[model samples]
Structure formats: structure tokens, C-alpha cells
Target: MSQNRRDPEQVVAAARKGAAEAQRQQIEIIKQFAAIDCGTGDEEGNARVVEIIDRQLKLIKGIEITHHYAEGYGIHIVARLKPEKPEGKILLSAHTDTVFHRGDTAAYPYHEDGDTAYGLGIVDCKGGILVAIHAVRIMQEADMLPNKEIVFIFNCDEETGTPNGHAVFDTEIPGAEMAFVFEPSRDEDGVLTARKGACSITVEVFGKKAHSGVNYLDGRSATVELGHMLVRLYENNDNVRGIQFNPAALYGGDYGTGIVSDHATAKVGVRVACQADIDKVKEIIARVEKETYIEGTKTEIRIDRISVPMERNEKNVQLYETVHKAGLLLGKDLPEQASGGSGDASYFSYRGVPAVDALGPYMYKIHSTDESMRLSSFEEKTALFAVVLGIL
Candidate 1:
């Protein structure tokens, strides 16, 4: 090693100091992120958030930034930092969009009280974005940036199942050795080692329409058939096995009770623990589509979106070990967990890149009005990530 190059302990010490110095700036940046109304499908709102991130990334020299736009979806930003003699590629990702819709920020503006910060979408992902930004900034400022190709992805669609973000991953993640997703850590300070697969299904039922009083027996009730199918689907939910079958919304029938309904539609959400469980869910759906409660009714099942599980495998475990070692350097023991909620991390893992998640601030009540993050965690996680980058 060159005399000018610091040892591992010295590099980590410099990163820790940088993280402490950047704490106030991180909070201000997170507030700016929280002020944006970048809901999942709000193109304009998402674009505004993208601009904020772009401006921040511009502050770091030698970064190559590109914007990828998906028709009918929002923009996904990819920033790259290439060293002269690259060791390998590292992927760090965080979503720009949140579950909060437009006008949510106006209703509940970003605010800090005591040791916590609260606002719409503050913790769900806005905080995560700040973590990634500060981590890179810390590494750059300390002159401790590794000799690797660092790829940072700020996806615009994640709350709605990453409709457009996956395309960005397909292009960028191929040669990356490992990935880190800056989602909020679990309330207990646990990082995600595994996540269940999720599927959004739309079931439509068709039936003959007729006047209830004039031809009640001739017409088949689609609503009645839908109810039976929903019951069967809900029966597949096994809490003990971590399988969730939720019939979230139902729509059917006209206002007049005298008329027999012709159409019915239902939206169902399913979560499975493993890849095999996905097949089981599909089998159940196939059986439901084939069987009918009403003799004349026909049912159609359409999967709106599907996210495969991030199973706990050796590669993922090895990545977690690296993260754990980094956490130990910071005097923290980061526990690994298997989450029921799915995330973009699963996409990279499925594509053969070792991945770990929940590397952001400690947060709770995500996607709810009470969503908030611990202010101190911003500095801690930033330091953790900077050290991880250094040691890598």
C-alpha cells in the first residue's frame, strides 16, 4: 500500500468523522425529499424527486448520471463512479417514489420532534435515499472511495411493485458482484436477509344479466360467484406458514337491486415464503378459475404483478456476513431477518447478484400516517455504509 493510503482502521475512523459532520446536512436533504409528492404513479411528482437526487449526485465529481424513462411509468436514475483501476462493481439502490399520493406532503409536512423525524414518505424511502447519498459523499470527502465501479440507482417506481424499475436493473445489474438496497431497517434494527414473494391478482367474473323480478332464475349472479371465489382464496392464507392471501378490493353489480349483475371484479394480494409456494398459489388460482359457484358464470384471473421471493441462500448469507463485519467495526451488531414484505432487492438476487437490504435509517410505521425515523440512525447507517465501501 502507498504511504498516502490509509489503513483499514484509519479509513473507517475518517468515515466516522465524516458521517458525524454530515448529520445536519443529511437531515436537511431528507426534509427536501419529504417535501416532494412522489407517489408511485405520479409522474410529475416523481420527476421532481428525480431532479432533487440528480442535483445531489452532481455535487460529487466524476460521476456519470443517466436517466431512464419508461412509458406510462416514471423515471429511473442511474449514477456511476468509475475508478481508473477498477476492482469490481458495487450496486446501491433506493426507490424515489413512495405510497403517499399528491397533496400528502402539504397535509403532513416534514417535522422533527425530539429524536425523531416525521412526514409522509419520510421513512418508507425518502430517508433511505439520504442514507445512500451521504454514504457516497462521506467516502468521496474522506478520499477513501474504493477502486471499484460504483453504481447508484434511484428508481421511481417501487411502492407499486417496481413496474419500470426492473428494466433499469436488467441493464445495470448484470456484471455487478453484489447489491445493497437502502430500504429502512426493521424497527428492531434488523437487516433483511430474505423476503417473501408477492403477487397482485385481478379476478373478473362474467354472468348473464336479467331483471331480478322478471327473470331471476334465468340470470346467473356474478357477484355471488365472486364471493365464493374470494372465500376459497382467503382459505389459502396460512399464518403459520407465512402465506398471505388477501382479497383486498371488490367491485360489481349496479345500484338497482332489481337488475341482475353482468360483471364482477376483485383484487387479491398473495404472499409466499418460497419459490415453490408461488406455484402452489398459482395452482389454487387455476383451480378457482376452473370451478364456478354459478353454473353459467365464467371467471378470469389476471396477475397484475409478481415479485419473486428473496430466499436465504449462501450468496445472500455471505453478503450479510460482509455487512455484519462492517457493522462490527462500528460497534453495532446488526441482526439479520426474513421479512414478509417484498422489495427491489429480490430482483437483483434472482438475477444471480448477491444482495442485502434495509441498510438505511431505523424507521417504523412505514406507509402509514405515523411513519417516522430515528434522527441518530442517519449518521450511524451512513458511517456503516461508508466503512462497508472502504473495506470492500
Candidate 2:
């Protein structure tokens, strides 16, 4: 007969063991990932990661791992851990993509000093992945694995907003009960409780090009039309609601020999606090689109919802409390915080699954060359996750 509940003492002990093991194993994982040149298009990163997963699954609960080819980028690894029963499925998501390309190590060398491991993607997510894996180990070893099933999704291309991973999750996320993301935590005491939603938009304006010296008055400049739209876009930014509009990229006909630009396009990035804000921004963008500043210019607009905001609520607050208290028991004060970026947790939170982000080890300089994680922070967070699992 199998046991229904695990002893608290046994669970605690197992968590401690798991935490220790995680530290040791993390060194290997880091070294392995370091060997891969997984910038974005490199397939070696995927191959190396798959090899590590193969070894990890053998030691832990080996689940099905699939490789997906996301357009415009490299492959994404989707791994699942299914329970015997079909209830209580939680997802732990992380990203494997980084902003650095091949010659990055020369600019930002990967090295260790005393207790900190420094390298690309170390703090941004690889360290976070290590934390999640150990958390699962704590639960599995203590026989206190979630009463619900769990899905461990470590994807590629998150550095660029799941451009490819989003579709993959669309097929897999509907069945999850909750999710926890291993994003880089704020300084040290921070836990990400909320994030703003983001949208990428491009507004194109077309006009008749004319000679600047001779026919400037006869032609309508598309650049002028784009300028007017950008003015309105900036005005729509409501800092109170965290709704921000930024004209990120602007391109028009020939810059060096710009006589009268015939076409101009601007890529804007909008960040909203919630879905309501998203709709509001859409309204604002529509209004801007209707107004044609240049008399003869034809304008077009395209919008893409990059990532939805991870809105916070009572349910997430409860989970945060559980995690916070666990940290206190480990003699650390972990505070639940909020962020301004989007991540996979947004999918689950919007689905009413209640999630928390930044449960990974404390790290800094993520998405950049100076990425690194503290050995002590990882150890404490690992133990706290174990404690939280027991309480849950």
C-alpha cells in the first residue's frame, strides 16, 4: 500500500537533502549550458540541453521531452511530468534563450569568485531552472509531490517574448491548475507578484516623395504623419496605470539622402497593467490611426499582443505568503514584489491558476554578460521551497 500523506519531519529532511544536492548539481548544469553556444539560432544549445535533460530524467522522474522548432529562432524543449491521477496540474515554466551571441564571452567572461557563479543566462533562467528542478525533487522524494499533476516547461526564445514558445504553451497550458515561473528575482528579497502586459505595434505611413530643394511643398512627408501619431501615443502613456507607449524603432525612405521621405514606419512598445488597459490602449491607437496629419499620406497600423500581464490577486497573495514564511524559517526575509516585464506565468495567472514568479535563486545582471547567482541564495530558496511544499 502507498502512503497518502508524508511525515512533516521526513519531508523537511528530504527538502534539506534536495537543497544540498541541487547546489552540487547546479555546477554541472551551468558547466553544461556554458559549453553550448545557444545564442538564438545555434542548435548546439538545444542538443546540449537535451543531453542534460536525458541524464536528469534518469535520476528523477523521466518524462517525455519534445523538441519544437520555433520560427525565426532555434528549438524549444518541452518536458512534462504527468502524475498517476489526472487532477491538480501545476506548471513550472522557464526560458532558455539569452540575448548574448557568440563573441559574448570575450566581452563578459564567465568566471567564479568564491561562492558566486557568473555566466550568460545563469541568473536570467538557468539558475532558476535549477531551483525548480530541486523543488520537484523535494516533493517527489518526500512523497509529497503535488496532489495535482505538474508540467515542467523549459522553453527557448523567452528572451524575445515567447515569439515561438507561446504557440507551444497554447496547446499545453489549458490543462494546468497553477504555475510558478523561475524568472530572475529582484535584488534578493524580492518575489515577482505582478507584471505589465506588452504589445508591439508598427504604424506605417505612405506619402509621395519629393525633392527637398525644389518640390518640398508639392509632396506630403510620411515622416510628418508618423510624428503626429507618435505624439498621441506618448500622450496616451498613463504612468499611474503603468501604461507606457514607446516609439522603439523608426525607419523611413533613405536617411542619408532624405529629400522628402515617401514612407515611414514606427515600431512602438506598449505596456499595460491589465486587460482593461490593453483595451483602452487599443482605443487610443485606433483614434490615432484615424487622424491623418499628412493630407495625402495613407497610413496603416499593426498590433501584436506580445505578452499579457500577470495580474496579482488574493490567490497569488496566499501562495506568496506560504513562500515568504518558508523563507523566514530559513532565517531570511523574502518579500513579495512586482515587476514590469512579461513572462510565461502570465498565461497561468490569466487562466485563474494563481501563480508566483521569481522563485529561483537570487541573481543579478540577467540577459546581459554579467549574469551571476549567489550560492547562499540558491541554497536558502531551495530549502524554503521544500518547506512551502510541505505546508501546501
Candidate 3:
């Protein structure tokens, strides 16, 4: 039963069968995963997740598992499965960390009601992790696994933009033909063809402090300067299509109401569609920084944790078409859409790896207590992923 001699329809049918058989077990696995609180920077919790995944991957016989750890970030696991007959290389990635806190899971554990499963990070990525793992397992059990070198990465820090796991991707992404990121599909089961680039900009304004009543005219208020800057920053949002500047958090002034504030700080979240958009954002930030709402006030800006956009390119569209064909095989129409959210997919797609995202379950309200994934989508997406791997 050589791969070339096998019928594509038969392979897809086998994937669907395997997916159906594993549906219940997959749900249980997600429950197990959701019980652990692997929030970003929770080293112990994230390590526990790594151990679970590592132990499971070891049972599969030929997977070469490597654990990468950074000082502040938890472990990142890279599991490679090389086929007997290698056709090409494929990369699969999912994040282990969520945006919730350590006790959030204890307060809101995984629960299933009818066809929806709810938890803190269940859909945001725990479900996605199961999809990546079980999709490979289903293909293997069906004897329909493709003759491609499969590299799967379960990263620990995606909610914070993968500052630690980017190093692993830097090494693993090259030479890979296509990448699938398990980042939970849109509520309507839409896969992401494009995602906005993101960065955090922190602005600090400094001015001289003085008594508000006695030295009102002489004193420069940093708080007033930051207030003006925030308004200008918000104006950048939608100024150009697909570009946004959000002043997410602001801190300024002491509790003393009688004193003019000497310092103010603003944390802005910037999202852009392309390099040109990023450049435009920088220009706007500079303009805001230079304008003086209050005399003698100086501003300093720091931009860090930048992630590039996942552009909708031809290769990405081709990969989406492959997934779409797989969906049709399962009698599902998985629409392709663009997302303002950023993920690990952007890393590969930005580097020309032909990446597609949201290959995970169909879920909504991720990063919140209302986070839930459709129970049926687990089987459906797993089957779709397995079929895509087989046909590729």
C-alpha cells in the first residue's frame, strides 16, 4: 500500500474515521490540559504542560523531542517526526501559555455544557495543542501519515508575543514548505490568511513638579502633556486602513492633589498591516513625542516586543486552498479571513514560509473567562488537518 498508489478519497475517509474515534479522548485531553494554569511567565505551570506534552510525544516511538527554556519564559518543546520516505518538511505550531493568571483556572476550571467547552485557555490554545498532536496521531493510526518531515512546536509564550520561543522558530522555520499554526479559528470557523503586526510603545513624560496653587503658572505638568499625547495617539487609529494606535494603559501623577505632576507614563499598543504601516506609526509617535503640550516637559519613548504582520501572499492563499479542499472533503466550508490579532504564524509567514493560521478548533471569546470552543469542531478540525497532511 504505497502512498502514490493509495486513493486520496480513501485517505480522507480514514482520517475522518480516526478523527471520529478519537473525539471523546481529545475532549478529555483538553480537560486535562485546561486544569493546568500555564499563563505567560508562570514557569512552573508552563513546565508542567511541557512535561505532559513531552511524555505524550515520547509514546509515539520516533519523535525527537527537544525542550528549550529561557530564563523568564518557560519551556518550549520541539518535536520532529521524520518519515521513512521524506517528500518535504512541514511545521506545526501551538502555544501553551494563555493570558489568564495562575489562579484563574482554579476559579474557572474546564467545563462542558452540551456542545461547548468553557475554560480560561481551553480554546485559545489548549484545544489547539490537542489538534496538532492528535492530527498526527490520527494520520499515523490510519497509516495515512504523509512522507514529510513533520516538526511540531509547542511554545510557552505566545500571549506575550513569543519573546522566548522566537529563537526556536528562527532555527526551525527555514526550509519548511508550509506551516500551520493552531491558534483557534474564528467563531465562524474562519482561518487567518493575514494578521496585523504588533508592538508595545511605552512613553515616559518628565516635567518639573511644583505646588499647583502657588506655582500654577511656573510649573509644567507632565500629566497634561501625556493627556494631549494620548488624544493624538488615538487619532492614528483608522487614520490609515489596517493601522491602529491604542493607548492601552496610563499612569501619571502622585496622590497629592496640591502638587503638579512631575512624571507620567503611557503604554500604547500598536497594530499595523505592513512594514509601511509600521513606519507610519513610528512617524506618528515621533510627532506626538515632539509636540509640547506643556513647556519644559520632555518625553522618552521605548518600543519593544514587535511582531511582524502575516501578509496574505500567494503561497499562503495556496496553503489555504489546500485546507479549503480538505474542508470540502469533510462537507465543511472553512472560510479564509484576516485577523487583527498576531500569533506565531506571523513569524513563518513574514519569513516567506507559506503559513496559514487558526487550524485549531472553532472558538470565541479567547483570553477571557467566557473562552469556549465548540465541542464538535474538535473532531471536524482534526479530521480536516489530518486530511490536509495526507493530501500534501
lDDT of 1 by residue, 209-229 (tens): 989999899998999999988
* TM-score, one value per model: 0.96, 0.90, 0.96
> Over the stretch 1-392, how does candidate 3's per-residue lDDT look in tens digits?
34466687887888889889878887877888888887899999988888778876765558999888887878889999997778788999998888988788889988889999988888889888888888888788777777789999988888888887888998987789999999998857888889998988998999889888998777788898988888877876875486777887888888477988989998988888888887887888888889887779998877866888898899999999999988887788889999988888999998889999998998878878889989998988889898887777
TM-score of predicted model 3?
A: 0.96
lDDT of 2 by residue, 1-392 (tens): 12236555666677777787677777777766765566665566655765775566455564666777765676666667776675566677887777778767556666788888888877677777777777777677767765666677778777667777778777777866667788867666687778877888999999888888887898788888889989978987888877889998899867545488888999999887788988888888888888887798888877865578888888888878877866665667888888887887876687777788988777777766678878676776677677776656
For candidate 1, report its TM-score: 0.96
Better of 1 and 2 by lDDT: 1
User: What lDDT does the true structure give each of the candidates?
Assistant: 0.85, 0.75, 0.85
How many clashes show up in model 2?
2
Worst 10 residues of 2 by lDDT: 1-10
User: At residue 75, what lDDT does model 3 achieve?
Assistant: 86
